[model samples]
Each structure stands twice: as structure tokens, then as C-alpha cells.
Target: MSAGRDDDAQGAGAPGDAARPKVSSVLFLCGMNAIRSPIAEALARSLLPPTVYIASAGVRHGERDPFVDAVLEERGLSLGEREPQRYEDLEDGFFDLIVTMAPEAHHAALDATGTASVQVEFWPMPDPSVVTGSRDQILDAYRDLLGRIEQRIRQRFEA
Candidate 1:
């Protein structure tokens, strides 16, 4: 995969709009930090406001899947700061918004983070781990997830 930067995917409006407090830094939650949440983090951090932080966590803890690294490398975001931390590891009500990549995580984040005070978005994403077939088949699902995240992040910031 080409490892450079995903900033080109943005419109001229990105830099100006990423500063919106309605969006701000986001926390992406999933069943695991392995796939969906990680992809969301990578895409959002790269395409949104450079100062706007993006982070991922799981309802349950697990190792950071290597596929997440490979996919994000293609999009040019460093995985160095992503340490597979759980939501409880951070303070509550810290993020301006929370994005749940799966329904299970939506429920979990609802319970764990008490998101009623903050914006919570449920994306209902499928687990990329369940993908079967060739490598491209797997990469395609990941790329598709990235596309969806990019769109949503743009919406939260620009619209």
C-alpha cells in the first residue's frame, strides 16, 4: 500500500472546518480496537483538522490487529500513538463526540462512557475480522470502512 498521506482526500474546506467544536476530537469505539475503530481513527486524524485528535478503543480490550497497521500505513497515518487502550483508561466526558463503529460498541460506549452528555454516533459497521477470501477481499472491506469514516468525519466537521 502507498504510505504517504490521506490529506489529499479532503476538499479545500477541511482545514477551515475541522476546527468546529461540534466535532472536535473524537473517540471511536468498537467491539475491538482491531479494525473498524482503528480505521476510523486513522482516516479522521489524517483527513480532518490536524489539531483535532482521533482515538479508538474497544468495549473489551484486545491487541491492536496488524491489519489495522497495514491499512493505516496505506493511508499514511502513524499507528505509533495508538496503544489499544480501553475507554475506561481515559477520563469520562473528555471528547466532544464519540463514534461507535458497531452496534455492540454503541451499547457498550453508552454504558461505559455515559455518552448522554456528549454526542454519540452509531455507525453499525461490520467486523472486518469476519471477512473471508483473498487478501484484496479483506483489504477492500477495510478500504470501504475507511471511505465511510471519511464521509462521516467530513459531515461532522464540514456540514
Candidate 2:
């Protein structure tokens, strides 16, 4: 993965025509932080306003994904030195919302945020790393995943 400075520029959230709740902080979670969740964290951090704190974790820690870096690089986003971490490894300890990309992470977030004010949402996303085929085919899988997550973010935050 290539290294680049984290983009701190604020992004437009919901448009003036749409109505959505204000979310100050968000956490994206997946079975392993390697792929989905990290992609989400990077996208959200760039796609949402700077006021929205963004982070990601997994049910279990895993190595950072090169595909994730590749896919994001296509959009001019870079992962830099960010590393994969488990849910327990987050230092902030709380988020206004938790978006889980896999069943395991969803359950973990639910259990971890039990009875708390934080909202947990399950976004069942396929793991692109599981794809098998030519390099281009595998990359297609990642591109598809990235599009889906981007669409979700727009709908939920930008309407």
C-alpha cells in the first residue's frame, strides 16, 4: 500500500434538500479490519464533514489489506499508516453510531454497545478478499464492494 497524508478536508454531508440526523462520531466494523471496515472508515472520513469523527475496527484484528489501498487509491484516497485493530483496541471508547459490515461485527457491536445511546446498524457486506479468479476479476469484486459502500454512505448521510 502506498503512503499519503490523511485528508482532513471537510466533506459535504446531507444536501440542503434532505433531512437526516446529525451524527458526530461513527465507527465501521467488520469481521476483520483488513478490508470492508477500513474502506468504510477511509471513505466516511473523506465523504462526511470533518465534524464527524470516523474510525473503524473488526471483531478480530487482521492485517491491513492491499486491495483496500488499491481500491481507495483509485479514488485518490490513501490509507497511509492506518492499521487494523479489534473492537477492543479503539482508544476513544464510544461513537454516536456503529456500522457493522459483517454478522460477527454486528453482534459484537450490539453486545459492546448494549443499553448505550449509540446506535448499531448492520450492513451485510460481502468480503471481497474471499473472491477467487484472475487479478482483474478479484479487483472487480473490490470495485463492486467499494461502490456499494459509497452508495450506502450517500443515502444514509447525504440522502
Candidate 3:
């Protein structure tokens, strides 16, 4: 565990622990996953219990967005081989909390994790694609979006 925070594997402690359920696995979702979802997953790993496995996927299985890689690089993290997967392709009964960063993702994650009784939270965040500029300029948007995702995860998951 890092000095400032506890990893999710040993998270601060889930609420209602008299008979607290197992540490919830987390699935971060987005439209294409080349961005928001992956960032959220990384941030979750840093803040939540280490045992809380995290995964991410997209609604449409679009091409891997370069911006997602760039954004994570700011924190010295890389999305190297983490290819994006369409929601329809995910295996069954895997995660406990499905976090949707895009509107479409909420429906998908719900349908995917809903049957498993997992919790779902929707976070309406901006798309780095909307950011128009040079390569460097666009990457800056990724950085900003990454910061937002990181901040939100910290607020909601950290104790």
C-alpha cells in the first residue's frame, strides 16, 4: 500500500460491515473505453482495495483511442495491451460495481452487471474527442479528463 492511501484489496472498509459483503469488484465503462473507463480503472486500483479487481469496456468496441494512453502517461501509467471490448463480449457475473462514465455505458453496464446484483453509478464526463487542437493540445484534454476521473474516484471510494 502507498503511504497516503490504503489499497482496495484492503479498502478502508465497506459500509454495513457487521456482515459486510465481500469487497466489490469494479468495472469502469465508457462509450469506447479508449479513455474514461481505463483511467477510472487505474484510479480505482490506486484508491480502492487491492483485492477489488477492476476492468473496463466500451459500448461499441471502437478503435483504441490514443488519448487514453496519453492521459495515463501523465501519471506514468500506460494502457499498453488493454484493448477495448464491446459490452456484449464481456463474460458473465464478474464485477460488483459498474461505473459508467458515458450515458450509453450506464445502460450497458447495468444490463451486464444488473443480474449479478452489483451496484452501478453514472458519471457524466466530457469526451476528450470534443477537444479540438494539435496532437499536444488534444492530449491536454486527456490529461484534464484523467484528472477529473481520478478526483471523482478519490471522492467516492476513499475513506
Candidate 4:
């Protein structure tokens, strides 16, 4: 296990627990790929096993947020190579799990998974873009958003 990891945060499955199945592919979605979904994707990339194929998208296409790049830089994470993509842009739209961070994304994921066996989880995250304040305050909002998504990712995948 990596240093500073706490397995008890979410009561994740114990070692050798047969009840939890390994997740192969996952999709993270939000209203825009600018902030939430991409951050979640980067967090998952750092935490989850490489065997898991992880990708993120928005309900509609959006430009990458520089605040996202700046905040993630504080964690030594980068999104330099990732271009924002919409659900319709995914070449392989199939995934074992679709994690949505916004209401619109949740509904879209539901519609996309109709008649399919995929699992859809709604996380209902806040959009930090709506926040207006000083430079520190704005960065704080992004940091808070990053923390929330990081916690959720750790809870669901860490053990």
C-alpha cells in the first residue's frame, strides 16, 4: 500500500473479499470536461490499478480549465495531453461503470446505458466555476472540489 493511504475511510472490502468485483473500465462524466470529470479521471489514474481502463467526458464538449491544470499541478498531476471530449466523441462508449458528477451527466449516462447492463453512479458534485472571489478564494474552491472527488475515488477504489 502507498504511504498516507487509509483503507478505513469508506470501509472498503478487505483483502481477499470475494464480494467486491474488480472494475475493468470506468467513465467519469460532468457537464463540462473542464473541471470535475478530468480531475476525477486524474485522481483515479493515480489511485487505481493500471489494469483499469479509465476515461472521462462531459455531457457536451468544453474547453479545458486552466484552474484545473494549476490545482492538479499542486499534486504533481497533469492534464496536458487530454483534450476535452463529449460522450458522443468516445470511440468506445462501453464501460463497466459510469460515474456522473452532475445531474445532466447522470441523466445522459442513464440514457446512454439504456437496455445495457452497465452500472451508473451519481456523485452530484458542485461546479466550482460559479464561485467568484479573490485569487486565493478561487483556488480554494478548486482545491475543495479536488478534495471531494479525491475522497470519493479513494472510498470507492482504495483498500
The 0-to-1 C-alpha lDDT of every candidate, in the order given, reads 0.68, 0.79, 0.70, 0.82
TM-score of structure candidate 1: 0.76
The TM-score values for the models, in the order shown, are: 0.76, 0.86, 0.78, 0.87
lDDT of 4 by residue, 1-159 (tens): 222122232333234445556779989999978899999999899889889999999999799898999999999999878889998889999887788888898888877777676767778788999999998899999999999998888767762
* Candidate 4 ranges beyond 4 A from true positions: 1-20
Pairs clashing within candidate 3: 7-48, 7-49, 8-48, 8-49, 8-50, 9-49, 9-50, 9-51
Count of clashes in candidate 1: 0
Candidate of highest TM-score = 4
Write down the lDDT that model 2 would get: 0.79
Please, what are the lDDT tens digits per residue for candidate 2 over residues 1-159? 112111111222224423335779989889989999888888888889998899998888699888889899999998899889989988897887788888888778777776776766677789899899998999999999999889788866873
The residue ranges of model 2 lying beyond 4 angstroms of the native Cα positions read: 1-20
Per-residue lDDT of 1-159 in model 1, one digit per residue for the tens? 112111122321244654334555788888767778877777777777777777888877888777777777887776786677677776654776677877777777666544245556576666778888999998888777777777776765662
In angstroms, give how far residue 139 of model 1 lies from its true place. 1.6
Superposed Cα deviation of residue 74, candidate 3 (Å): 2.0
RMSD of each: 8.8, 8.9, 7.6, 6.8
| Candidate 3: tens digits of C-alpha lDDT, residues 28-121 | 8889877788888777776778777888888987787777776677688777787888767878546666677887887666555534555566
**Model 2 compared with the native: what TM-score?**
0.86
